[model samples]
Target: MIEDPQGTVLALFAAFCRVGGCFMLLPGFSSARLPMQIRLFLAVAISMAILPLLWDTIYPRAADPVASYVRLIVFETLTGAVIGLIARYFVLGLQFAGTVLTMMIGFNAPPSPDVIEDTAENQLTNLISFAALMVLFLLDFHHVILRALVESYTTMPLGAGFNPQGALITLADTLKQTFDIMLRLASPFIVYGLLFNIAVGLVNKLAPQIPIYFISLPFLICGGLFLVYFGISSMLEIFAAAFIPVFEGR
Candidate 1:
């Protein structure tokens, strides 16, 4: 019943190239804490699942001559990588914001093992980054990304080749939007840190004999923690709400 089984296999591999590339850099799935075997199998399984839907588009190209097929592989992988990087960069921006937030609040606690990755991160930074990622997962953000990937074949068709300039522009735009949103979320703390530090400095200047800076650490931490307790819920809400627009816009 099956004719051209070779082409089917080749087409499946082609699909795998793109999906695997995206999974290679996707946030939670790409974490070092996850086993490589799981990631590979997930990528392969998704590729197979998507292949039927994209069979017509991919099959013809799958039969390309060996040299052309190699080129296709490269282009498909790069295209998928560019798409994956767009999402990855946005999450990384939030992580960067978390780092900045921790520093601003004077919560320079010793770094601990990151919950999502193998890297060590400041506890507060880890908490913020992990929470934001968790919120995205809860909101089914991966579904959005996967949907975009499927729709992308229309915009970026198979064998169309990769456009480096376009990819760069897309990535740059993602960073700009991500930075704007994260900055808004962290601005209150930034202002708090500045005003608190300024007041502490003035008090220290007047009370020369007192170790005001050392004395002020507890107040600074307490105030920062207080702000975080009240503000984190709203911050995560805003972050989750913004993901759809940011991702689709880019």
Candidate 2:
């Protein structure tokens, strides 16, 4: 007997909801402050467009109509979210570094437009985050993510049992790797803060009346800005290298 079209569509819609929920929280695609409805539409559109192509290979023909559909939605959403989040992890590294650099350079806590729900990041963090995002896109990191999704189908197929521990491990590794990259990204600024402050301290100690510490802020800030501008290319290159493996495979 032919499967009910209404049931199939409903099943697809359910799958879309789960996938879109993951996208709603994932980075890059959900980075904008667009209305929830618009984001929902985009997510569903992506899912629907891909469904026809991958339906046979991935989405099971609706059978039980209850448990099977539920499992399909859950697994599909988890996979999409995992892929999206892997990319987000890399982006967070840059953001973390920027936050530190900004604080060190006395540029912390500057006003910034809200880009996500519940809060806004510092302007410096936002800038670095945006730049890193561009670099990731330039590297076709999204393609890599899509590839990973394709690979995930083999490791964790739709309607299969969820792998909670594996997902946890992946997420944990992403967070750990992000922190490592952020430290590397912020190294120059950290060094600048250290040596620059040390030099100012020495001068202040020597001449007590010179107020060298106060006088050096502008020089330090300008020098830091220049260094960052010159170093960003290299920084992003390193980031790309670090990001490739996470999206590529196990």
Number of the top candidate by lDDT?
1
**Candidate 2 lDDT by residue in tens digits, 1-250:** 5366775676567557446755766666786566778878877787676666666644454434456666666666776677677777777667778878987776655567745434677876777777777787787876776555545656766667677789888888888877877798899899988898898899889889997856888888888889888988888888888888655643
Q: Which ten residues in a row have the lowest lDDT in candidate 2?
A: 57-66
Candidate 2: misplaced stretches above 4 Å? 1-3, 59-61, 66-68, 114-118
Q: What does the lDDT read for residue 104 in candidate 1?
A: 85
Q: lDDT tens string, model 1, 1-250?
A: 7698888888998998989889888889899989999999999999988888888888887877654888899999998888788888888888888888888889998899998888899999888889999999999999998898888899998988899999999999999999999999899899999999999999988998999978999999899999999999998999889889989997
Cα RMSD, each candidate: 1.1, 2.8
